[model samples]
Target: MAIEKIMGTETELGISAKDPRGFDPVSGSILLINAHRPIAEVKSIWDYTGENPLLDARGFEVSGERERPSQQDNRTINKLLRNGGRLYVDGAHPEYSTPECTNARDVVCYEKAGERIFELCLASANLSLPERQQIFIYKNNSDGKGNSYGHHENYLVDRRVPFDQIVQGLAPFLVTRLIFAGAGKVGVENGGERCDFQISQRADFFETFIGLDTMAKRPIINTRDEPHAD
Candidate 1:
């Protein structure tokens, strides 16, 4: 049986606002998120009622409590674009989540379009900044420091397939496939170890085999059971 191929992606671009005093990424992210607000054709709040970060994919609840997205997030920083995509501030970074795409080509088009949208936003946002202050955005995942951003992808799987089977079949590919799929990076070093380059920037950061947490102790298999079906 063939499964319908539905896909989408979310990218968090690294941003820096530099001035004579210092640099602020939080302010830069906020500016980029709000850049389209003034000219937005339709403003729709993200409905968070269906969100359940605590529900595990393994069919049991997690121990820690789920924290609802704050009211400030809905009112201030989130926007549903006219192109059907979503732009919002996630943590200290501005994230662009592409609308549902049916095939690989459309997915690529939408992802590239996201970068153009950010470029336009940055151009608009910079006009309001001081002459000496400027904002720069990078599509890369890491900040060269210990912190890292993400390029998250979503897919729709047939409900007929057992979840455990799905995980078992996909684990090896997800763990080792980075050899060909990784975004190339500069050299890296930890303690006395050093390497010229790495396959995936986020690979070395995984601390556990399964969990719902994304920032700390990131799991190879994300257990969060948020429904992707619409």
Candidate 2:
């Protein structure tokens, strides 16, 4: 019998502040995440001891420096929720990563819960700001500019399965499923052909068949192998 798949999702939300002094997305994101008060008192510090983002599944380490935020910055940016989910800042966006779930229904529930959590945080953060300088959070992936953030999905697959076989099986499905699953965009981006509208917010960003880069020169099959579990 096939093993039951444990799945989760990570969403990087778009953020901005309506400030006359000019907006700083990173600062706004940090403020938004830090304002949240989790129901249970849990350590906000994220343990990154075993994380190796540079280690690619192709048996090579990528050339890049791993992020090492100061302890104060880490505390201000990362939050551990009572529901076993994570809320943090990723780049200029505030992100929420859902806890592991055994089924799609549970994933949907958790994702909705995350939205509510963000709303709560937004209200809390806005209380300290003037009405004209309030921060805004968007669930969309793109900011209508050249930049695109990630709405990544994670699935637990058997390590015994060949990577090539897995890619072959998944790539076609991911490509075709965009027709029905895409969030729908109003305009093209990332140097894509001139189109007034498109299906997937991320479709225009894929530039390679396989690669480890997530922000730039993205790949159809990302080779990052950090499974977040042993």
Candidate 3:
């Protein structure tokens, strides 16, 4: 069956930007929203490293309140896959260990707690001007105890601007914003401490979501009284 052929789905709805609603149908940029209720955490039973569950490493439960995301990234990706959808990996979300992404063109890491993450590509052959999809999955490294992670979002600016300038310009704007996917830690940096973040940065997004790539991958920490929005 043609993927374009509409399939009746209660959980699915398509919209043309030119419709009566103010949604813009521009080909260059489009936002595909997953309206489904996202899980608060990823529960798992397998222990990847057979290490003692009581190991006190740098990422060992930062706080008793559970400092990291509890949900495993694979589960979220698997769910999207079952729904016939995928995500983008790029430099924005890279593998753990050598977290820094040399490809300036790809998305990158700024901050991370587990120092590990998973990457995926939902869009076909990079982002085209017309329509494309990109999904990024961040999995908190787990040796068993309580863990955490976030499904951060990245917008590929296809405009013809210098990557360095873009990185500098986008940072300030991003530091002040949050994503609708959900709330999580944010920062700016090329690869903060390796796979421990989205974009290595000098500051963190405090309590707000969305980290600016001001310093390439580092994110500033934001703290304010503004009513939070998810």
Residues 66-148 of candidate 1 have per-residue lDDT tens digits of 55667776756787887878888888788899999899899889989888889898998989988778788889888776678
Question: What is the RMSD of candidate 3?
Answer: 19.9
- TM-score each candidate: 0.89, 0.95, 0.22
lDDT of 3 at 81: 26
By TM-score, is 2 or 3 better? 2
Query: How do the residues 1-230 of candidate 3 rate in per-residue lDDT, one tens digit apiece?
Result: 22221111111111222232443422211122212233342233222233232322222322222122234633322223222223222222222222223242322322221122121121321242233232322243211122222233333333344545655676666555534322333433322253444432223314323332222332332111111111
Superposed by TM-score, candidate 1 places the C-alpha of residue 71 at a distance from the truth, in angstroms, of 5.6
Cα RMSD (Å) per model? 2.4, 1.5, 19.9
lDDT of 2 by residue, 1-230 (tens): 89788999998998877863788888899889888977667865888777778988877898888878788877788998899899999888999999999999999999999999999999999999998889988888788887888898999998889889999999999899988898998978876578998889888888899999988899989998888877
Give the runs in model 2 whose Cα sits over 4 Å from its true position.
none
> Which residue window of length 10 is worst by lDDT in model 1?
184-193
